[model samples]
Structures are given as structure tokens and as C-alpha cells.
Target chain A: MKVTHAKLLAQVPLLTDLPTELLESLAKSCRFEQVNRGHVIIERHDTTRRFFFLLSGQVRMLDLNRQGQEIALAILDAPTHFGELAVIDSLPRSASVQATTRCEVASISPQDAEKLIYTVPQVSRKIMQNMATVIRNNNLHRQVLQQQSISNRLAAYLLGQLPKDIDPKETVCIRNLPIQYDLSILLGTTRESISRALTTLVDEGLVTKDGKNLYLNDIPGLYQLLEED
Target chain B: MKVTHAKLLAQVPLLTDLPTELLESLAKSCRFEQVNRGHVIIERHDTTRRFFFLLSGQVRMLDLNRQGQEIALAILDAPTHFGELAVIDSLPRSASVQATTRCEVASISPQDAEKLIYTVPQVSRKIMQNMATVIRNNNLHRQVLQQQSISNRLAAYLLGQLPKDIDPKETVCIRNLPIQYDLSILLGTTRESISRALTTLVDEGLVTKDGKNLYLNDIPGLYQLLEED
Candidate 1:
């Protein structure tokens, strides 16, 4: 998509609630770029000052171990945002983000974003509100992860993926699976362990796995597994 | 301190850069109060619209666990601030703060702070700057804790207590230390482990513990311990 067109569409709540004209101006100040799969978008400790919005495809935010093994911190799908922390704090990126698939992204320099926000009160309010949501969600995830057991963590995470008002008994199909390695990192376990756990669930008729897709066969059974003594 | 005096002192900063009469009016809006040790200053999930500034003594920010354990997240000493997160986000408190020692605090209702800041541009700038500093420090601590090992984390925690720009070789004394249980929670470990580590450090001549006081016998040695395999 052309940078102008992409920026116009980006104003769809995820970017800001600014008017089209304002968003177009903001977009003009930003740069649009495509990154290939396996491209490192951001590097830990790199002091580059850019905020990113995923326009298409996926990016995995990861922290590297001493030996450089990547541990997935989060996965940002299209329409989601990342790199706001650097812009907010004027600090180096805390974690690296790598393209999990060929992706399109919109980039805003920190100075540009700050200038726009200060000059536009509406933009500043919208950005602050967006940041507040991010902070709230991040804090909630940290709390849940710190307190929940591995199984409970996985269950809660899966449940969160469902619609907010969905019936508890509703069977939802999950497709375009997040990689097992990513799941392992999120659960603070090994991919082998995640595979073993999923296998157990499948054998028990709790969930059905077909290739890269999974369907909830028994929601109660999954809950039982989460609550197992 | 008397409420009137505390209110007056709180106005000093807000008034310094504002017109003299405006500062006096803002000061009149503040509410001063003393809270004894163990008093709950702010309750979790409370939407009470008040922000606090520490005048004296210590306060602890805590989150309660399901098992009823109070996880101490931070200690706020004199001249420090708390309750600003709720004010900024216009949300209920996510954590509770209590007086760890008899605390004298000056408070401004969120509405009052908002009014004063809106009327006084200088006050708004100062408050924003203060918030940025607090957020940056909080994020830095979170990153350090997430990335460092237990020993290194402990060492860094101790180092943070010392005066900045002090000679690295200079030893500092920590007196009337809090209980081991408190230290365990702060370091994300158990009391037994903290006791064991302290004993080991003592044996290694890195530190000395006598009664309620700990003397760092060798600052460089403590740093080496943090860098150990």
C-alpha cells in the first residue's frame, strides 16, 4: 500500500482517533517500509529512535539469552503496535523485534511523534490514552504470569483469545497457529514440553489438533487440566 | 507537621515558577494528614481521587496475593511520590500503599491538582517532568530485575542505595536493616535463601552483618560476586 493510503487506514483506532487530514499529515511525516521474513526490526540496546506500527504480517518481540537464544516476549500481528516504550522513555529498545513473516510497517521517529503530539492536543490525548491501555494490559499480563501455574497460564491465555462475551461452552477454532517456540517462551517452558502437554490434551479428547489448527473439543476438560491437583 | 504547614510546603514548588498569588491559592487546596505505621494509605481498586506526596517517614507499595501475602513492590521514602499512576490514568488503584513507618504526607485531590496544573503552565511542566522521571526509573528497575541473576540483582539493589558518583571502592554501611522476609520479597527469593547467601557473602569477606547493621567490607568484592559464574 502507498504510505499515504496506509496511514489513512491506520487511523482506525489502533493508531489514533485523529481526523483523516491530521492522520495524512502525520503519515506524511512517517516512513512506510516492508521487511522480509527473518529481518530484525529492532535490536536490544540499539538506541535507534523509531516507533513502529505493524501494517501487515507478524513480528515477534524477543529477548535473547546469553548464548543468544531468542525467548519470545510477545507477538505483534497486523494492526497492533510496538516500540512505543522507546518513544515514551527516550531509552534504547528493551527487546528486539524480528519479522516472523514478510511484513509491512509504518515507522515514526520519536522527535516527529513528540512534535506532532505537542502541536496537536487531540493527538496527544489519543496517544496518552493508547499508552494507558498498553500499560494496563502489560501490567495485567505480568501479574497473571507471575501468579499462575504453567497450565493455568496457558488456559487463561487461550481463553483470552476468545471473544469477551463468548459462552464458556462455545468451541472456538484457533488457526494460523502461533509457533510452538513462541508458545514455549510465553509459558516459560520448552517447546518439547508444550508439544507433550498438547499431545496429552489431544489424547484425552480435550482438544483437537489438525495440522497447524486446533479446535476446542471440551472446554471443561481443558479447565480441568488447568485446575488439576 | 501541621496540615497548614505541610500545605504551605507543598505550594513552594508549585508556586516557585508561578505568580506568587496563584501559588498561595493552590496551596490552600491541598489537604495534609499524618498516617501511622501499618495504616493503609491507599486501598487497591479504590477510585478515591487523591494523590499523595511523602513529607516524612516511609511508605510501601504492595500488591496482595490470593494467599494473602503482601508483595512489596517499592519503598517510598520522604520527598517521594505515589498514587500518581491512578491520577494519570483516571483509573482505580492497581496496588495499595501503606505507611511502613509513621508517615507525614501532603495530598491534593486529583481535581485540585488538575485545576492547579491547568491554571499554572509551569506546574504542569514540572509534574510531567516528575512523572517521566518516575516512569523511567520504574521501567529501568523492571528491566534490571527481569534480566539479572539473584546475586547480581541483590548487588545492584545495594549499589542503588548508595550515593551516585561515589567512588566504586568506597564502602557503605546499612544500619537497622529490615527483616529477612522483607528482603526476600524484594529480591524475589525466600528468607532461607537470602540467609544462606548472606552467610556465604560474609564468609567470603564481602560483607559483615552484626546485629541490625550490615557493613560492606569490600565494595569491589561485592561487584565481583555479582559478576561471578
Candidate 2:
């Protein structure tokens, strides 16, 4: 395999599992592109016939309502993929994707991606598994974000990041949260409101913040706050 | 084919398109069950091993945040399917499914469903297509609900339900929205708040309440309102 093709395929967990021959075939069809920060990879309601897998950098899926208030649906890091809807059904883009940072992405024509899935059994299973994962995570996230209360939203968001096997009483540190401004956008609140909510959380003994990292010393207490909402 | 089996298979839009022999084979492994109103067909965090297809009746997909605030994800009518995550990958149920009305349902083991998807090309394509449809609708619904304001939320909700082919200037009546209580739960607001939003829409000449229906007289005006918020 070519070094660049191998690197891109290795980055995406889904493509790494494909057999060498199939990977070689897919790599041959792959087109490499570099997108600048704030570049819109796809636009809402555009009927385009392409699928993109982010090889490096960050991509934000943006939703802008009629009032022009924009919220992010998701922020995807490299090795993650987008645009599978058009790949599957030629559907118009429902949301826009913009590079949150200068990014490298590998492009595949919908026809090429469809051919990989339809004609290759192993590739089909791997692709389906990846799609299932996207659907599962999306449902779980929508459920959490549906909470009405800001504190509840924050608590739920925190608890969601905790390791599943961790005990409730253990101290947990959550890192990698979006900054306050972006978080407010995701939670549909103002920066001031989000700050106030965090302060309230701190006063209530649910969490402590050390810069960008948050410490949860009373995990069960936080659960109680979420439960009592 | 058994008459009951054929009847059940024919009712499901996803399965009706499959060959009769294949459907018959699938029906052989099916287990029929009757769920009462408010029956919990699936539970969040439950590691259940089956996927369900609603043969007759109404079902609500629900999400309860850690705060115990419950919201309905969707209200699915018969001839619809759910729980493919477990079938495809044996993942735990991410959300709950409850019977909104007394209902009849047929279930297939994940093993059996996997057999069909892996061995039958047409069945695999059909299932994937159905999944793509679900993912697409989920993304769109999430986008509409991500807006920050209640009035904006209500307006976006109404606009989303409009038929795609309708002209922007045309008159449209949206009916069968959840009752105020349910709408409040779904929209993350109080019944009083939802009422206020609707009244505001009426006062703005964007929507006119006619009995149980909402007549959207100027679709663009409603959209403009959505943009301004």
C-alpha cells in the first residue's frame, strides 16, 4: 500500500479492518484534500454526491435555525467520518460541516463508497457496524441534551463522560469539554448562563474546576442533583 | 406460509418488500407478544437480546435524563421497527420503548436478524436503507430542537412538520401535535410556557389556532420569525 493511503486508512478505525486488496482498491479511488479552518465542507440542503472521512483535524456539524442562531450538533475529531447519508441515499445535506481547525480529509465518491459496501462482504459488515455506532451515540446524545435544566444538562454531560465501570463515590476528573462559548452553543444557553450554572454546581458541592479540567469529588451527589432536577 | 405469519410480515413496510420465502423463514423464528398500554417494551441500559417490530398499535421512544426528567423521543405507529443496535452489534438498549397504546408486536432474535442480513443481499440492503432513513430523520429532528428560544422551538417544530412540496407562500394547517402537557415535555418547557409561545405566534399573524389545528397562513413569515430569534 502507498504510505499516504496506509496512513489515512490506519487513522480511521473502520478502514483499518478492511482486507489489504480492498484497502488498496479503496485507496486508489481516495482523493486527498486540505481544508482551512472555518471552511464549509458541506452546506445545508445541498444535494452533493460525495462522502468524506476526516483524516486529521476537527470538524463541526452545525445547525442554524431560521432565527440564525447556530448550534453545533457534534464536533468530530479525526478518524471519524461524515456524509454517509448522501452515500446511502443521495439525500441532501441536512446540516453543514465546517473545519474547526485546518484539516486533512480523504474523499470518496458516493458511488465508490457504495460499491465497497455492496460488493465486498467484509467491507459491508465493517461499514454497517460503524453506521450502527453512529446511530447509537446520536440517540444517546439527543436524549441527554433534551434535558430542560442547565444544571441537569451539565450534570448529565459530566456523568456521561465518566468511565462506565467507575464507582459512584470515586473522584473523577473530566477533561476535553468544549470551551465555555462553544459549550453554551451546544447547551443552547448564554455564556453568562453557563458560567452561572457552573458556579451553582460548584457551590452545591457537585464538582470543582481546575482550569479546563473539572473534578467530580461527589459523583453520587451530582447524580442526586441530576435526579432531583 | 402460515396465515398469521404472512399477515404480520405484510404489515411491516420493511419486511413486506422482502421475498415471501425469506419472510416466511424470518417469521418462523418470530415470537408474538401483546403489550398493554404504557408497557415498557425496552428499558434504558437494559442488555436485552431482541429487536421488535410493531405489528399493530402505537409506541413511544422515551428518554429520561439523570434528573429523571422524561421526554418522548418519538411516537411510532405500526408497521415500524426498532432496536436494530442490539440486532446488529448486541449493544445495550440506549433508550427506552414504551407502548403508548395497547399493542401487538413481533420480535426476532438478534441472531436470526443477523443471519438474514449477512446471508441475504436484498435483505441487507433493505435493512440498511431503513436505518439510513431513521438516521436522517433523527438528525433533522435534532437540528430543529437545538434552537435556544421556546417560540423558535415551536416555530421550527411546526415548519419541520410541513410537507416538503408545499410552496413557501402557501397556507398550511398542522394538526395532531402533542397535547400541551406532552408538548411541554417534548419541548423542555412548561405547559404555560408553550401556551404563551403559541399565543405569541398567533398574535404575530404567523399562525392561527383553529380548534385543534394550527393554520400557518404565511410560511415565510413563520420562517422569518424563526430567523429573527
Candidate 3:
């Protein structure tokens, strides 16, 4: 789908909070690009000239291990903003972002982003708050993953990815699991470990898998698993 | 130790950049507190009404695993600032901070910190830049640690803790080792792993260990080891 001006401006999380006039200005400054799956949208060491926000589809932020294996940092979906670090620090890109699926993304020039920071306090504060949230949550998530148990890591990883606003009683259906190989990269483990953990979760009736969809029967069960020695 | 108006203001990294009038205002707003070793300066759910800067001695940021084992996050020395995340986001403290030694720490209320942000653009920019640097470096460090090598982790970790301005060619001394238990917690490994990794480094002449003092004989050797796997 082509990214329409008003629709996209109002849809993106970054611009959605702005007033109509500011949104209009943002819309004017943004350039929308459609990228195919497997497109490397941003490479490590890329210039700090522009920031990106996903309007649709998925993107993976990743790094390469010394052995040339891809280590997944984050798998981001629509309404997500990234690359702001480069803008804030005026530094080269620290990681690579690639399209995991055909994606619609909006790019904003750093000059415009900086102008927004000074001219628009509300937007600036929101961005900073968002960054703080990411930093804090990412730190917590990494701490969970650092433990030596693959089961605990997978459980904590799944729980961490749920939206903050997700209803406690809601049965969250996650169907976009790419594949076991991809999941292994995300957890920094092997495909065998991912499969083993999934089997255990299924055997315990904590979660059920049907085709590409996974169902959480008991969210607290996952937490209980983490508490196990 | 009493916190003199000039001495305290000069030592705190946050206030050092401000002009005299501003520093005077900040010094007045700050509360200088001397804490003893093992003092719990901040708890997990503490309010973010104030921020802290260490004037002297060591502070450790830590968390408890489900089994009640401690997980070390960071060990900070003088001229370090923390709890700004709470101040920035108005969120509860994400972790616990304990004084690792008798410490002199100065704190500023969020209200005063806000005043500085409005009154001092350069200082605010510098704080943001520092925060961005933290986020980037933390991400990289976590990535390095997540790989499955205890020796690589200890090497990368020591290299990481070195002051960024340290001369690459100079023989820098880091004598503030926090014992084997704390080192194991920081690396999410067994105490035995820490001992083994240290022995390996010493054996290879990559680093030399003298009592609690560990000396890096060749920093590049550690980096090369990381590149090997």
C-alpha cells in the first residue's frame, strides 16, 4: 500500500502525538519508502543524517558475530521508531536494520528532527521519554536473557515483547514467529534449544502451538518457569 | 566528610559544567550525604524525585534473581551519576543501589535538575549525549557478553570498564576489584569460571594479576581474542 500523507502522519507513533499543524509539518518533512523483504534498510556505520519509523511490516535490528552469524538485537513491528541514537549523538550507526517483511517506512532528516527538538518541546520530551523507556526495558530484558537457562530466557523474552498496554487477562496471540532459526538468533541460542524449550512449554500446558500460531494458556506459568532453579 | 560548597560542586560531574552562579544555586539545592559501606542508597521501587552523583567511593547497582542470588549490574566510582532515568521518566527506580564502600554522594531534586535543564542548554545537551553514549555502549557490552565464552567476557569486561580516555599504550592500573563473588555476578558465571578466565589471561600474558590488582599487559591481545570467535 502506498503511504498516504494524512493517513501516515496520523498513523506513525512519533507524529501521532503531535498537533495537526506540527503533524502537517512533520508530514512535509518526511519521505516514505517501501522496502522489500530482505532489504538492508540501514547498515552499521551508516551516516546519522536521517531517522526511521515503521509504518507497516517488520524490521530486525541485528549484529554479526565474529563467525558471521546474525545475532538478533530486536525484531520491531509497525509504529516503531529507531535510528534516533545516531541523530542524538551525531555518530555513525551502531547496528544494522533490515526489513523482515515488505515494509513501509518514513524517514525524517536530522535537520528537521533537530528543529523539532528545539521548536517543539512536547515532541522532544516525548522522544526522550520513549528513549528512556527503551533503555530501561532493554536493560531489564538483557538481564533476563543473560541467565544460563534457555527455557528461562525464552519465557522472559516472550513476556518482555508483549506490548506494555496489553490487557492482563487477554489471551495474546502471537503468530508472526519467523522460524526456529530466526527465533534461535533472537534468543542467542541454537535452533535445538528453541525447539526443546517450546516442547517443554507445550508439555507443561503453559503454551500451545498450532501451525505458525502460539497460544499462551497461562501467562503466570511462564513466570513460574523462570522462578525454577 | 563535610561537603563544602566549592569542593562538592567542583567534584560532581553534573554541576562542574555550570557557571558559578548556577553552581551556587545547585550546591544550595543539593543534599550532601555520607553513607557507610553496604548502605542501600536506593531500592528497586524508590521514587525518582531526586538523582544521585557519587563524590567518593564505590556504589554497586544490583538485582536479586528468583533463587535469591545477586546479579551485579554495575560498580561505579566517584564522579558517577545515576537514577536520572527515574527523574527523566518519573518512574520507580529500576534496580537497587548499595554503597560498596564508605561513600560521599550528592543528590539534586528533580525540580532543581529541571531548572538546570532549562537554564543550561549546554549541560542538558551534554547529559543527553552522555545518555546516548550509555545506551549505545551498554548495548554493545551486552552483545559481547551474551556470546558463550567466559574468558572472552572477562577480557571484554575489563577493557570496557577502563576509562575511555585511558591511553591505549600506557600501563593503566585498576585496583578496585570487587572480589570473585561480585565478578561472577557481573558476568553471570560461576566463581570458578572467573578464576579460570583470570588464570587463562595470566597464563597467556594478556593480563597480570597481583592480589586484587589486575593489570592489562596488552589490551589489543584481549581484543584479538574476541575476534577469534
DockQ, in order, for the candidates?
Answer: 0.21, 0.49, 0.48
Candidate 3 total steric clashes: 0
> TM-score of model 2 relative to the true fold?
0.86
Taking chain A by itself, what TM-score does each prediction score?
0.83, 0.89, 0.84
Best by lDDT: 2
**What's model 2's lDDT at B131?**
73
lDDT of 3 by residue, A1-229 (tens): 2235656767766667677766766777788889999999999878855888798999888876655667777788897788877888899887899998899988888988677654465656666677677677666766666767787787777777576687656667677766787778877788999999999888988788889888777787777877774
lDDT of 3 by residue, B1-229 (tens): 2336646767666667666766676677789899999999999777756878788888888876655677787778887777777777888887789998899888888887666653466656666666788778767667666756899888878887688787777766678677887788888778999999999988998888788888898887877888775
CAPRI verdict on model 3?
acceptable
Weakest lDDT window of 10 consecutive positions for candidate 2 chain A: A64-73
TM-score of chain B of each: 0.79, 0.88, 0.83
Docking model 1 quality class: incorrect
Question: How far is each candidate from the true structure, as Cα RMSD in Å?
Answer: 4.8, 3.3, 3.6
Q: Candidate 3 has which clashing residue pairs, if any?
A: none
Worst 10 residues of 1 chain B by lDDT: B139-148
By DockQ rank, best first, the candidates go 2, 3, 1
Model 2 over residues A52-164: C-alpha lDDT tens digits?
A: 88989988887765546677777788987788767676778867898988999888888887886677776667667777877776666675566667877777777777877
Descending-TM-score candidate ranking: 3, 2, 1
- Model 2 docking tier (incorrect/acceptable/medium/high): acceptable
